[model samples]
Target: MANFKLTISDKKGKSQSKELKDKEANVLVGMHVGNEVDATIVGLAGKLKITGGSDKSGIPMRGDVYGSARKKVLLSKGIGLKNAEKGQRRRRLIRGSTISEEIYQINCAYDGELKIEEAPKEEEKKA
Candidate 1:
């Protein structure tokens, strides 16, 4: 079963993290960066857009790249490289845009109002 840690961000810049397992996580598999996810599946009411993600090994996903495999691409500035010269290019390891079972962290942008209902606590349930 696939497990994923989702980092959802809103227009206000506030972000929240959610952990999904099994079926919930499976819904995200095969989705690529720039794809829209069903907010209902993740307990949200707005639209969730996949921006980027990283694997368990910390390799970042790049939208320009295809498939779910990792590759060493020469970059001047982008996800893989933070500090770059005006005209500098270097080979860096980057994962493809597609989400796979190996991906652990997913970054998303949310649009629309968020209304998450809290689940009842164990004590409340017992009472």
Candidate 2:
């Protein structure tokens, strides 16, 4: 079971906080950095974009960098004797992790009416 405190603000600049538990909090599982979810604030709807958050394991979640060509180019330019593995390690360090209950803090940006929906379901195909 996971517990989380969500602080959201609507377009009107009014802010409110809510505590989510269990199934409600599970909606955030598997969401990577920058992913957006519909949330409700004070009976109003809004969007919650995951700007940054951490896991119960204390590992910080970061947006994927593999999609960035500039970062790849810069990573390839390291010039130290032990630099061979630095880029590899750095890549592993910046990627976000699968969500877990340990996530205590989640920061998000709220916007206009966001319709909360059930988290996407995973389906497996029989081979």
Candidate 3:
């Protein structure tokens, strides 16, 4: 069983922290630090991009494409490969191992606007 800690902050300096169990943590399997994800906190939904985090082994974790080995080659190619193919290649290069026992400390920022709507009040009955 793995646990992940998430620290989420909004543009207005408001922040929230929470923890996720194994099942919930799996949703972030492919996502790395600095990656943006849609999240809901206390009924307020928005987008959040991870800022910093660490693995179970205490190793700092970062986004897949942040400091990749193949980044240079991929970016150097002068549009040789199709967009889809390029994307596939990039995924393969940055994907993490499945067997790693890493619990990430994700710091994310809310990117989307949180909108709350109030129901209109009904008029009082006339005498």
Candidate 4:
């Protein structure tokens, strides 16, 4: 299995890092329904969910922050560990996925994207 070390950035161009399993990383590139793999977060419960934004069409749109590259970022619940609300009252729509975890969410930014290549893996020196 391959892993992607994603560098998540915020609107100001500041960045943070995280890792995702191979398949889950692919979903971010292909943002469509029925197109998430294991470890993929979906629906309105993740951090990448639009806490504040709207589609130009004037319709209420909320979901993952899909970008031009296959960067599967954001989260369901749009919920971050910071300033979070709990209980059944929290969800506008509830769906099941590992997406709710904090590991998935980086703070929202006007501009953020996943790094194109995996960081170099370390090699052990021979004794």
Candidate 5:
């Protein structure tokens, strides 16, 4: 399993980092890092909750993007409204995407990094 580094920023403007395997990372890459997300009974959209993680943890994330799993959602217990606002809009799934595609989508939603690494030149094969 390849580990892709993830940087998730919470609503309070704090950011966290984590390493996800290809499959799991793919599913979360394009979602907003700190929004609460829940699954629709009919499977239309996932709910969004607060983004949570301790200051010592990397990418303190909460709220599952595709399903209703128990999560903290919020980062701070003392944080109150007016300082930040969370969104509830569900992300529309893209057509013809691999597992990586899901991560791509989540990152896209949160404006996550999708940098294309440049490939190094290699010797051509002689057939």
Candidate 6:
């Protein structure tokens, strides 16, 4: 039973977030970065491409890395490192590219039209 928080982005730079659990969350397991998934799985109508994700501990996944294990890779300027001087490199802990049950958040890029309908606001009657 895995739970996941999905952050979906469209070509227009718009993004939406959704939470999935149990069976819905299980659909994302074993997927890797750059892989494509159906948006319908998350109640959307489009195709979603897997970009990246982070584990329960907030360790980000790197595309260069393989499998679903955490590793300490030497990074100069990347997702893990925020502010680094020129020619500066440091070993940072990052997760692999694969998605697993331990993953907490998954980032995706959506392809196709996305239209989200909002609930209508009610008007109060004047006394």
Q: Please name the candidate that would achieve the greatest lDDT relative to the true structure.
A: 1
Q: Whole-model Cα lDDT per candidate?
A: 0.91, 0.55, 0.53, 0.34, 0.33, 0.89
Off by over 4 Å in 6: 117-127
Tens-place lDDT per residue, model 4, 22-95, is 56654443333223233224212223421221222222223343322223233334522134445323323222
Instruction: For residues 2-38, write the lDDT of model 1, one tens digit per residue.
Output: 9999998888877888999999899999999999988
**TM-score attained by model 4:** 0.24
Give the true-structure RMSD of model 5: 15.8
Task: Candidate 2: list runs displaced more than 4 Å.
Answer: 9-15, 41-43, 56-59, 65-98, 113-127
Q: Which candidate wins on TM-score?
A: 1
lDDT of 5 by residue, 1-127 (tens): 4344444443455444445566554444343445444422112243433243222222222333333222334332222212333553332221211122222112212233223335455654332
Q: Model 3 reaches what TM-score against the true structure?
A: 0.50
For candidate 3, list the clashing residue pairs, or say none.
56-103
Model 2: per-residue Cα lDDT over 32-127, one tens digit each = 667778765335565687766554453444454432112222233222113555446333232233445666766666767444455455653332
Rate residue 5 of model 6 by lDDT.
96
Better of 1 and 4 by lDDT: 1
Better of 3 and 4 by TM-score: 3
Clashing residue pairs in all predictions, respectively, total: 0, 3, 1, 13, 24, 0
Least accurate 10 contiguous residues by lDDT in model 5: 96-105
Could you tell me the lDDT of residue 37 within candidate 1?
Answer: 84
TM-score, model 6 to reference: 0.86
